[model samples]
Target: MEGHTGCTTKIVTLCTFKLSDAHVHYRTPLTSYFISHTSHLTSHWQSITLQNLYLIPHTSYPIPHTPYPIPHTSYFILHTSYFINNIYYL
Candidate 1:
């Protein structure tokens, strides 16, 4: 987490299958989350999960400083991504 302290963009990839598998398995696409340099990734995602759970569609609720509203379809994706990211970090 050394170089990550600055304002830099990072790409976090979440895979559906293990890397040991060579077979061409279908990958589940995930929605990308752009976290700010000022925030911790895991903690921010956890907060996002909460906001998404309670947010209604078409509401003006933004994910913290982000302008995007929580979409109905993103509920499952956010939870899955958060869990995956948490596991990866651990």
Candidate 2:
């Protein structure tokens, strides 16, 4: 994975293989910025979200309800779950 920063923005990049099977997961403790991507031999999976103090964007994936205290800024946690065949992996 690669992370980049601009004047007031951040970017992240990741690479994967086509034949590979993978699942990605993410969670945040506070409002923050996060983006994720998965690469296949033919295409890539991309997602981006910005968490604000007042509101957060809707995501296709469901987020768990946790009772962690949130600060004024943004926080992000990213996790990827990978599985192959009948085997479980991360």
Candidate 3:
């Protein structure tokens, strides 16, 4: 989050929602995410689907000379790890 907008303050927040509609085909037509940005320095809001959602405190990688090496992305990605049906997030 450094040098992105020339702001050193970290107010980034990652929000994720996992949705599963029980149907043989398309059953649910809903855009179930609320995202808004009042300012450029506001926290980051992202809407993504996940089979399993887990929160990690911090993540590290083998990148060099990176201000924020730890990714601020969602801890769980959609349809990758855990699999479940009829999962509704509220």
> Highest lDDT among the candidates is held by which one?
2
Total clashes in model 1, counting residue pairs 3 or more apart in sequence or in different chains: 0
After superposing candidate 1 on the true structure, give the runs of residues whose Cα lies further than 4 Å from its correct spot. Answer: 1-62, 76-90
Q: Cα RMSD (Å) between model 2 and the true structure?
A: 14.8
- Clashes per candidate, residues 3 or more apart or on different chains: 0, 2, 0
Full-model lDDT, candidate 2: 0.27
- Candidates ranked by TM-score: 3, 2, 1
> Model 2, range 21-81, lDDT digits (tens) per residue?
3232344545332322322212443342212111123342344542343421222223223
* Candidate 1 per-residue lDDT over residues 1-90, each given as its tens digit: 111111122222222222122221123336433322212232333212221111122233234443444443222212223332232110
Tell me the TM-score of each prediction against the true structure: 0.16, 0.18, 0.22
RMSD of each: 14.8, 14.8, 14.8
TM-score of 1: 0.16
- Provide the overall lDDT of each model, using Cα atoms, as 2-decimal numbers: 0.25, 0.27, 0.26
